[model samples]
Target: MPITLTIPDGLLSPTAQAEAFAALTEAVLEVSGLNGNAFMTSNVVGSINVLPREHVLVAGKPAQAAFVELKLPEIALATPEAKRTFIEKATDVVERAAGGRLQRDHIWSNIVYAPDGAWGIAGRSYDNGDLISAITGSAA
Candidate 1:
């Protein structure tokens, strides 16, 4: 899984940006119940893009906004409840990190599931079963 975070450069202090990234990672793993799974933990990766104010847009107008997008295989956050939990928690993590600098309404989050076998890491593609086996350290 990869969690991408995009925020206006000034929206968060350097310390907050680092805090948010770490919190966001934990939220994803915790919500998906993969917190301690080696494969899942190692694969949970992404970039934090701190764009210029003018480059950040909301409703076609430049604004202070943040977006957290998660791309993962089907089995990750597989349930509606799980996805909802992640959205709520992820948004909270970002907002809190901003130290009230960002409006809750300005934060957006979404989980996008890849088709089975379409997710990859280190040049190896993984399907639902492949992930399960790796996470559990067992043959499927």
Candidate 2:
């Protein structure tokens, strides 16, 4: 899984940005019930893109916004409740990180599911079964 956190420059302080990224990663693992899992923790990687303010937009106009995007296999966060929890928790992380400098509505979150066999790591393709087995340390 990868969590991409995109924000307009200056929306969050340097320290806050780093904290937000860490929190976002934790939110995913925590909600997915994978916290402390070595493989998942190490593989839950992504970037924090602090783009120019003008580059971020809302309805064709520039806006101070934050975007949280999670890319994972379909089998992850498989339940509706899990998805909901992640979204809510992610938005909360961004909001708290902003220290009231940004609006709640401006912080958006979404999840994109990779098709089976399309997810890969370490140059090896991993299907749903492979991922499940790797995560659980047992046959899927």
Query: Top lDDT: which candidate number?
Result: 2
Candidate 2 lDDT by residue in tens digits, 1-140 = 88899999999999998999999999998998888887788899999999999999999999988999999999999899999999999999999999998999999999999999999999999999999889998312
Clashes of each: 0, 0
| Cα lDDT, model 2, residue 81 | 99
Candidate 2 lDDT at 125 equals: 95
Candidate 1 wrongly placed segments (more than 4 Å): 138-140
The local lDDT score (0 to 100) that residue 35 gets in candidate 2 is 86
lDDT of 2 at 29: 89
Q: State each model's CA lDDT, in order.
A: 0.88, 0.92
Model 2 residue 99 CA deviation in Å:
0.5
Q: Give Cα distance to truth, residue 54, candidate 1, Å.
A: 0.6
